[model samples]
Target: MSAKTIVVGNFKGGVGKTKVAVMASWELAHEMNKKVLLIDMDPQANATTLIARSAGITEIESSIFESFENSDLSKSVLNVKENLDLIPAAVSFKNLPKFLYGKFSDDIDQVSYLKTLLEPLKKNYDYIFIDVPPTISDYSDNAMMAADYVLIILQAQELSLEGAETYISYLQFMIDEYNAYIQVAGVLPVLLRPGGRVDHATVERAKELFGEDNVFENYIKHLERLKAWDITGITYKDHHDNRAHQIFIEVVQEMLDKIEHFEGGEVNGE
Candidate 1:
């Protein structure tokens, strides 16, 4: 099987992007029998902490930020759970702009450094999911550029739409300027207050703007399954409540289907 990387990102915050990233990685690793690498790029380290706790491991503090200035990979990486590994986040990462752009002087293309670092590890995992922060930076750009495809998570709100639009425009710029090889993984809709006024309309607008082919077939309804599973030390797919578990399973399979479509195009014509 071929390796794939999916980036979960949005330009605006507080839209469950991190949650989606964590759940997607967990589902892939625990449910689908796939080896997964979860890269916690956000300084918050929510995904890192969540997975670490689930596995009864220590919450991670140090992360790929250190990898930017340091040569040692061991210091930045942690095996947070069975069949899954993580590169946690650090508070120091918040101040990485000058360090990466100014201090790393002569020859390093810091943008692709993370990619180079992961090249040797690609064969070890079937999927790598990168959780990006709301702000734009080399860290987010590097991950997106390195990825086979990028996934943008959006909520059914005007603010979320603004963020998604900004992100997609930036991604289009990157693809045109530097990463002509990259393809968008897809846009996933996480509807807030599932049946609320304007939410259904918001979903329709999203499909129209992103194109029908780029939207997920399964729209994530507002549900308590996530928080419940997070607090209980169980996975969504492992919950006794089969309804919620099945919805997420359908999402995972839909993502795989979209990715496979891209791959098929490459083999057939590209």
Candidate 2:
């Protein structure tokens, strides 16, 4: 089966991009029992640390920097458990762009070189989930072109809303001008507004601006369990009974159903 490569990205940071990427990868691997590959393209390496212990400052060999520069990345990958593999990250990833900038001076496709390198691994896993940085860097561009579906997570707050608009406009331009095959899954509205409110007014505004059908039907509430992983190294599968973990399981199922829907005209319908 051709696995669906999904990317979790946002132009604005602190919207839980790493959280969703880690949780989704675990859910797909453990709950769905599908082989999952987690690629950390973020220099912060938050997702890598959360998934694998002691990241951010650690010198991980299987990181994107080494692999992107023609290092033996395949050997750096670690088996997280049954059906889950991880390409960890290091602080060195911050310099990947400068390292690769001079390699292909005239090639427009050079930005997507990482994705092309990873394409061969499509046969090695059932699902590939990428955690991209919160900026429009070369890493983000690589993830965008490589992904079969892109999920943009955002909050309803003023700053995040503005970010959504700006991000949509820019990526839309890129889709029109560069990658036409890139498919935007939806804007996942993470209801981080305090007091557990959705601000239906804002939701309606977004739907009016970007299409009602394109908006995700479900929203992840602001839960303490969602942030509990910050101090802990356990991922969703490791803390299977936690509320946030279960929610992640549900969210991954939702994404898988969407993938099935797009591939053929059917959802899991369960």
Candidate 1 lDDT, 3-89, residue by residue in tens: 687888788877778778887877777778788888887777777777777778765556777876775555677786677788877
Worst lDDT window (10 residues) for model 2? 53-62
Off by over 4 Å in 2: 54-59, 157-160, 235-241, 265-270
Cα misplacement distance, residue 100 of candidate 2 (Å): 1.8
Model 1: residue 11 alpha-carbon error in angstroms? 0.9
Per-model TM against the reference: 0.85, 0.88
Candidate 2 residues 73-123, lDDT tens each? 576677877888888877898887777676777445666676678777887
What's the lDDT for all of these models?
0.73, 0.73
Query: Pairs clashing in candidate 2?
Result: none
Give lDDT: candidate 1, residue 34.
Answer: 80
Q: Give lDDT: candidate 2, residue 233.
A: 59
